[model samples]
Target: MTPLFIFLVLLTSQVLGGLNNGASSKNVGGRRQPTGGGGLDENIPVIEIRGEGAPMSSAQIRHLEEMDNGGPLDIKIEKTFVPAKCPQQAKRLDFVTFHYKVFTEDNKKVYQTYGTGPVTIQLGTGMIMPGLDKGLKGMCAEELRKVRVPYRMSRKSKSKVWKNIPNDENWLIFNIEMVEIKPYTPEIQFKFLDLNEDEQLTNKEVQDFQKKMKKEFGKTWKNEDIDNVTAAGYYIKYFDVNGDGIVTEVEWLKIMDRDEKLINDKKTKEKGRKRDPGIGWILDFDNDGIVSYKENDEAADRFDAGPTLLPMESKDEL
Candidate 1:
C-alpha cells in the first residue's frame, strides 16, 4: 500500500476505537436514571406524626388550669428508656409499679418514693391526669419513658409529694417505665399494637386511635375499653414495613428473640448477668439488681440541684 494510504487507514481505525470506548463509558455512567415519583422525604424520619390537641378530661383541664395558672415552664429530659419507638402495646394501666425520685432542674433531690403496686388505671378513663395516663397509653412491657408534663397537668394532684414543684408551670419530668402489659384473652379478639423502630408517633395517630376506640366501644369506656378493643381490632398497631398484622408463628418467635436480645443487652450492660452460679459478684445498685436513683451512684448526678448541671456518670465512670 502507499505510505499515505496506510497512515490514513491506521488513523481511521484508532478514531473508531476511541469512539466505541466513549460510548461504552456513557452507557456505564448512565446506569441509574433519576426516579420521578415522590421519594421518601429525606428530611423526615419514616415514623414522625403529630396531631392537633385533643379534648382534655374535665379533671385534667381543671388540674392543668391550676398547674399553668402561671404559665408553661421549660422542661428537661433527665433519663429515658424509650427505644426508637415507644409504648408498643399501648395498654392503659393494666399494672404499673415503679420507684422514682423527683429532682429539681439542677438535679436536686426533691421527692422520692417506692410506691403503688399494680396501679390500675383504665385507658382513656381520665382516672389519672391525662398526661400520666396518656403517657402510659401504648407503652410495651418493660419500656421506660421519661417525659415532662407541664405543671398544668400535674400540679393539682392530691399527692402532696410532688406539690413542691414550682407552678411557674415548669415542665414536670416523668421518668416512666412501662413495667408490665397484660392483654385480654384472644377469645375477646386480640388487637396487636406495635411501638418501636421510630423516633415518636404523631399525635394524630394517638388521637385517631382514641376516637376510633371511643366510637366503637362507646365514650364511657376508658383506657381499659380501648385496650380491650385493641386486643380485638385489626392489627392496626403492630404493622411491619410490609403492613402485616398477624405475625406468623415464625414472626412471633422472631419478635420474641429480638426482644430477648434487647433485654439481654440492657441487663448485661446496666447490670452484669448472673454468673459463678452462686459465687460471682454481680453488679448491683446498693446490692439490688434494680437500678434506682436512690441506689446507684449514677443516680447521684441525676439528683444534684445546683447552678451548673453535672453530666451523668456512666457505669464505666462509676
Candidate 2:
C-alpha cells in the first residue's frame, strides 16, 4: 500500500485496539462479577437454594452482599427499618449497648440477645466476631444493620466459651440494632464498683472493683503486685469516714455525687462554685440511720453493672 493509505489503516487499527483495551481494563482482578437473576439487579447477591421440597427447598436469602468484597465480614444496612429517630454516633472504644439476633441461611433463628437486657460491647474489641466488630462502626443509637460473619470469623463463636451459639452452624447472620451508647459515667463506675449488686460497696467489693479496674483501665499506685496498702484499702480509708466496715448506698451515692459535683466544678472552673468537702456531706436514706439495700437499689438502674458476658436469652425481651 501507499504510505498515506498505510498510515490511515494503521490509525484505524490503533483506535480499535485502544477501545478493546479499555473494555478489558474496566475491571481489574479482585473485583466481583455481577450476580444474575430476573427482577434482581445483577450487581446484588442472591443465594439460590436448590432442593427437592417447597418452602425449605426454594428458599433464597437476599444476600445484599455488595459489601462482601472478599473481606472477612459483610454488612448490609437498612436505614428505613428503624423509626425516624437515630441516636448519637458510635466510635472505637466506646461502650455500645445493642441488641442482636443470629440466623441461618434457612432463615431459622439461632440466637438472640433481646430477652436479657440489651447487651453491652466495647466497639473494636475482638471479644465479638471480626465481621460484626468492624460492621458496627459508624452506627448510631437505634440504627439497624445486618452483618454476615463468615466461617473464619465464626470460629470463635463455635468455641465452648461462646456457649450461646450452636457449634455446628458455619455462617452467622446478625441483625443488630443500637439500643443505646453506654458512656463511662459515675453511675456506671459505681455499679462496677458495687460488684455484689448489694447496693453497698464493701472492702472486698472495692478490692475486686479496683482489681478489675486496674486490669481494664490502668495500673494502680503500686503497679501489678498486690500490696499491703491495696487499691481497695485506699478507697475504704478515704470514703469510709465513720470507719464503718460497710459503705452504705448513701455512702455510695455520696462518692458518686462528689464525682458529679467535681465534674460540674471543672465545667465552670472560672465561675467558682463552693469547694466540695470530701465526706462532710449528708446522706441518710432510712432515717433509721444505715442505708438499706432497698434504698440503695432505688437508684441502682442508673449504675447497676451489666453482665460482662453475653446473656443467654431470646430476642423477644426487646
Task: Give the best candidate by lDDT.
Answer: 2
Best by TM-score: 2
Per-model TM against the reference = 0.29, 0.38
Error of 1 at 240 (Å): 44
Candidate 2 residue lDDT tens string, 1-318: 112211111223333343344443322123433332232232333333334434421112123232345433344444435546555577665678888888985678987878865666555433455566677777778888887665555544232224576534446778888888765444554554576887776767766654543454322321123342343554454455355667665555565464445445443322211221111111112122233334333323312322122212222321
lDDT of each: 0.38, 0.49
* Superposed model 2: Cα runs more than 4 Å off: 1-83, 114-117, 124-127, 155-162, 167-169, 197-203, 206-318
Clash pairs of candidate 2?
none
Error of 1 at 232 (Å): 30
Stretches off by above 4 angstroms in model 1 are 1-79, 82-88, 92-99, 115-118, 159-169, 184-318
Scored against the true structure, residue 216 in model 1 reaches a CA lDDT of: 36
